[model samples]
Target: MPVSKKLPQLFYGGDYNPEQWPEDVWLEDMRLMKQAGVNIVSVGIFSWAILQPNAENYDFGWLDRLMNLLADNGIMADLATATASPPAWLAQLHPESLPVDENGVRFSHGSRQHYCPNSKAFRHYGQGLVRRLAHRYKDHPALAMWHVNNEYGCHVSRCYCAECTVRFREWLQQRYGTVQELNARWGTNFWSQKYYAWDEIALPAKTPTFANPGQQLDYMRFMSDSLLDAYLGEYRILKQITPDVPVMTNFMGAFKPLDEFEWAKHMDVVTWDSYPEPTAGIPVAAAMQHDLMRSLRGGQPFILMEQVTSQVNWRQRNPLKRPGVMRLWSYQAIARGSDGVMFFQWRQSRAGAEKFHGAMVTHTGDENGRVYREVAQLGNELKRLQALVDTRIEAKVAILFDWHNWWALELDSKPSRDVLFLEQIGHYYKALFDAGIAVDFVQPHADLNKYRLVIAPALYLIGPGVSDNLEAYVQQGGTLLTTFFSGIVDENDRIHLGGYPAPLRKLLGLCVEEFDPMLPDQTNGLRVRGQGDLDGDYKCTLWADIIRLEGAEALASFTADFFAGSPAVTAHTFGQGKAYYVGTHAEDAFVAGMLRRILSDLGVQPPVMTPLGVEVSERRAEGRSYIFLLNHLDQPAEVQLPAAGFTDLISGRKLQGSVRLSANEVLILHKDTEHAV
Candidate 1:
């Protein structure tokens, strides 16, 4: 089977913390769960304290009873390995499990993610506990998937411990092969900071700070890799006991702590916790995360591991998801190729830090609440149409999101503060979205031939073979877009000098002479070089790279500055394809307007071109394509879809090409079965 019932269609439920509440509550919780239509529960996430209360003693009585109850209740348990936050006893006994911050101070373990990733004691015990747990319930009828860890890198930027320092040296050796090469790449000779031996190096301290961004960036990579190793350690044990089961770790959305691309290599299926802010452009932000998760598996459907049933407790303000927001977001995930939709919690906790966090059954323990009603309705709808839940969405555009580049660029204090990486990438993504284009957010090393247009915004760190892969894409006539502050650094956060935009200068057809960072109010105008529909003056700022155009033509020029009339945007026609470089940040209009022309020049068209605040996506499987039309507006509006003959999957009504939708309404049209995957 291409899919598994272990992760059933439209996964209907979320986290269950039997460890927090008493055993008497389990039956009632299960009763409330069935009433609220929760079919799956993620158990054992934070049960380390209960499962193994002491070093010598292991208690499985509570968890075993909980799993048995779930089996009897017809509920599937998304069994977590119970290794996110180590028990207090272990941390107290083995002090090495506690993480040390960048300031070289040991942190107290009150919250989760405080364990040292490189600690041998933590790995041995953590994996041992998981092995025992998996073996105990490996063949349980209710066990679905093995969830490895909970939110792998919630505190992404920590860890300056002795173990990390030692491991960092080894990671450097493997990456650069020798100390001399490492020293040269890091420019250690500049400050007379060259290391004669590997053991001499220390973790970069933050308080009495040193301006060594390259070292800091490399250390971040080392830390993320270390955590990945920790996850794999437990994962290996689980697979050893139960080889047929799929394993996963929940990722934070667009989280920069660890390279998710690298982490995805070891996962059986990619899963994530999705909680976009209410103020955020819902579809755009959620789409980016969903595409990111999907891209990890190269367009394979991923699991929506955790979303809040009502609201979250962590943010400054926990607001209830508006009436249709939940359903719309759920379908949006499906529309973006998600095979499962689960929440952070099943039942509300009466006590704990997460008590206030929204749950299906509130503190009242009644199903009369508004949140419960919404959950029930959504669950019923999903149950009615389970066949559509495992569908897929494929696209013609791919944007490369490299955590390596993201870490290196942010740590490099040299770049302008205005060059915020995710924000810049969001600009291009928003442009493509506004133009109604379907995009696959991908890793740096994804198959280039799958996408007609591949955008790599601020690819600061040039990883192994990425340049060659990109060059091959351009050679094969695919449109490539890269920006300034890109191609300047290597994988180790070391500068690639000789010329600016190092490895990709030839491919981009522009040699960047110098770049000047600007403030928020700073302005640079772009004058039209050659006349087209976009011949008017446009605004650009934040940073301007004076371009030495080799084979590329200046499409737009800065109207004012020392380098006035210099190229702000350039395009190189290489072989049968082209590469465009945006030298500085431009307005959204400029980006959208420019990209439309470029995508048009390449014959790429949006499935259904519509106005802003509306999202159109198509999910296809089993010889049927379901076009999801969402109107994120207060007022009703009409959209002219591509086809006249189709039935709305939501309303079960036939629709013409010109169709109408109400405010916050979703119209899923079963259109063009021939093109379905």
Candidate 2:
């Protein structure tokens, strides 16, 4: 219920739905929530069916009762428009609202995200329902922020219907302006794809002979825009009624179906669900997502809207999060920049697709379950650590992660098939994360000089303002790094043909003449030049861009290729700063070693207490700073505390200089002295 402009320290509680149960159950739920210190509940997420069963018939009897109960309990309701999925009656009556697939097949009801965003029937009914709900509950005392929709990627690529085609034509016109431009971008001249009029164009269909990647990429962009337009319409309508309430939509982390970065520009707040893969390197993946979400709002903290305390129901092999893993992961999000912590379902469901997903309270309604106990403990600890509210995490490292480049790289049919984008970015990210260096995952347009060291791996597509930003950053004494296939294409996916690397050639001081694409098993030798203590040779593979140094100095050279002895790694001094361009996909060891040396040179040092294999992150507020040290290892590890005396905020133990941490344990140290960057 704390709606202060300065966000409260811990965002307690989670999604609650009293409408799903009986009155007696609702009463008990409230009792348990208060005991657990639950302060907020995201209500009415999927209540569209109950709210509007029929077009002309609306019911708020149950919702009114639910709100009154929350108000009595002093719980803030994160009210939702319930417009993610419309009622079955709407789709049954107006079939056009149901989306058609790329294969020219229209979908049936029964699943969420079934409505076509471009369908007028769907837009009218959806916005009308939202308008009604906003007017009805705008003045409710229990209302917190507005959650516009649930996770937005349940529906795949949509809208090949007639209405969609018309809108798609309009979008294309706005983008390309003329058929000649469209033809050139899509390479229409190669296969007699010359379009005389806008009407002649069609979406990328899943036909046996007509699967064009460029066209499909554009279709993805269009679909994302279409959904964003729908979301914006609902948001504006709600804002018209409740202007002060923040509006957000739950986003699926690392979802490839939609461009969430573009969608984030219009939202009042950025929020996302975190469900990491159970693989060996999930921490890196999770960190990448957390940083990406923060970058969407220009480094502002986002809401960790949903994560399971234990096993989930959807994965084929559901594995429980090991002891202490949940706490560590939650702190990982907070250490990055998360303002709130929540889960999908407060209480486990008895029937539905997510019946088995872990919840705060199980179906048995027991308060002593393992998950419930963990939630209870976290709730208590959050109550004590109230100083972290609205605090910021500072970083000197910047890793440029662009959705446009990701999209473009995947669509590249000519590059080596093994050159996956996320995997490459993740390799660098893991190196930095393991080194305990705070990294900002950014888009091309982010502020450059805020970071001392900038790492841009696989920057395949450069946008309008990126080159200038990098140029400025380098001129202002910032270290810039980029890899192969960079500066090859502009925002429109058109080739920048003044040489291989367009505008960055001057900054990099290298001209790429030819590139060698190799299979996964193929290997190349990278020999270090200009002998030093770290001078040696290494193995590398995948696509290698052969370069000739114009003004830069070569650090490494190819050993056995036709272009042997050519510069594989070059460093160029722009003004007060420098740029390193790695023209090949180098080995992880070499990359880590090179980055370590570069970071050392740039004075990008982690805290003196930073340890290997452990995560060290710091967040600073007005009067104090919290240093989070987490042991992600399976075995116990010892840690060196800050030189100055400090206290463990989580454990209430005072310490002087050093400490030992158990496996998967986390320590939040409160430093008395302030260090502002």
Candidate 3:
């Protein structure tokens, strides 16, 4: 977790807002926290209004007493800088700090994240508060970690105000270094959109009809960088004052507005909030989020910063988390490589918008409630499971994920409106997850030589260095699988000249002559022509490419499209390994069968085979493997033991045969072996 020396165990608490309750209830919070085996609590996340009521007035007496009480009770504090929500006084003094929407309407300062990213007034006040907090808490005994500003771009990712427009011009200047280069890259000569001066450039605000795709893509980049500048402002101050205290900000899983890969580089440790909807694909989606967080920093152990104890108050239909579902999800996070299990809040609120939100201490203030009892049980289990901290899930497979590609591919003038980046990512990742194969999410230009199998899905926009990086990986005997619509455009959202997939044509041994984007209600069939392993007749939808083979051989052909006999799937042998291309978005049956066969050819096996609803994952450290078996079904299920004998950490039971698990069950087993780390 890379925290202070005072916190040497697993973290197991949530947001603690002592300012919400009176002094009497504050004392009760300490008692309940101890009773629930809580070791750490996030303090003062949204207390700016009370911390400093006026511009010159500061109140620290209550917070001082709370910190002392927590330290005396043997609890650690994940202290927030209190910069997420601006106080009412700041808003009244300078309303220009308020953010504006895309339609040129400025939002009133009532909700959280109401300030603009480039507002000078907001930065001035935010910096002042951060300096004071860092100086005051540098040597405090309760301080273990520093929480930067809340979610980076929850509501106001893009601001169309005059202030932001001026900054966007400056960003463009720095990015291009000259007006001539901006014109050349943006391809402004296409539709009489060339700019003669820097002042002519403006924010991608509401435009009549369609805006320039190049301009819109650059605006997304500018917005992402502007938010990053806000984080770095507070981070530099915290590090200069308290260099020993680790600093981080909470991330929303798979958030598209801001680039998480870039943000993870500056953080001391990664942390994110997980709020998966109660749906059929909950297990796979939650695991994908965990893997994405863990992969942000090259497989560093992250913390589950915020999750619901039971029912949340925000969703359209908030469903109460069934009994044992909370614990099951927590263990799933740890299984993928999370060091801590935390929640959105410690005690449920009695007022405000989040009063109905579940917490460790319920509104009834009873320690005997169903949700509170489950929280206590899980906290105690975490205390005994501290040995699993810092362990890693070492997967040999890597999934390429790039935010630039995602943003550019989903721009307005694309081939198909139904084609999205995350959907294709989910398709590829689910195939691996359902087979019980752990996977890591990586950027396009990252080092891919360590992985045996690399899967890139819907890589519609390939930059300069990415092609070289991927080509070298395939040349060095690594298996690569990419889908349709890849290698189409460069970083500037300009199509590559000569042919489609131009950069990767030699490596893939095929060319996409044309993209046949199917309408939302259309479908296509996939006829298997590979080895007699998969279903002969499979269907696809959303997209099918007319592929022309250069040196590759067809593995599957489209059945109902104009290019029915053309290659829908092809396999080519590049330098010492193989590269497969799927010219169509086939259904799960075909994708899963092909991926499983490829993994079998590489001799990469799953940890253990289980029933349909059961998930198996393993983490290894110090010559020992910790196996996690979770049942995501509503009914009981059984799994065969993959080893001769092992010790169960949850029940302290030793077994050598099959084990039966009730609904929503979890069994963390330990076995000694030499893992190929």
Best by TM-score: 3
Q: Looking at candidate 3, what is the lDDT of residue 520?
A: 83
What lDDT does model 3 reach?
Answer: 0.89
Among residues 3 or more apart in sequence or in different chains, the pairs in candidate 3 whose N, CA or C atoms overlap within 3 Å are none
Q: After superposition, how far is residue 669 of candidate 2 from its true place, in Å?
A: 1.3
Off by over 4 Å in 1: 1-3, 207-211, 281-283, 529-531, 672-677
lDDT of 2: 0.81
Candidate 1 lDDT trough over 10 residues, lowest sum? 1-10
> Clash pairs of candidate 2?
none
Give the per-residue lDDT digits (tens) of candidate 1, residues 556-592: 9998989998888998988778899999888877888
Looking at model 2, which ten-residue stretch has the lowest summed lDDT? 1-10
For model 2, residues 1-677, the per-residue Cα lDDT tens digits are 22333235567667776667777889888888878777788898888898988988889988888888888997778888898778889888899888888778888888788888888988888788899989988888878788897777566456788888889999999999998888878877766778899999888766667455567678878888898888889989988898988888988777776787788887777888888754454387888788878878777778888888787898888888876777778888877878778887799888778889888888777788777788888777777777666677788998887777788777746566676778878878888887778888787887887899999888888989899999999998999999998898877677888998987999999899889888767888889956454478988888788897889999999888688888888899999999999988888888888888888887887754556767888877666688888888887788777578777787788877668888878888886455421
TM-score against native, each model? 0.95, 0.95, 0.98
Model 2 regions more than 4 Å off: 1-7, 208-214, 278-282, 529-533, 673-677
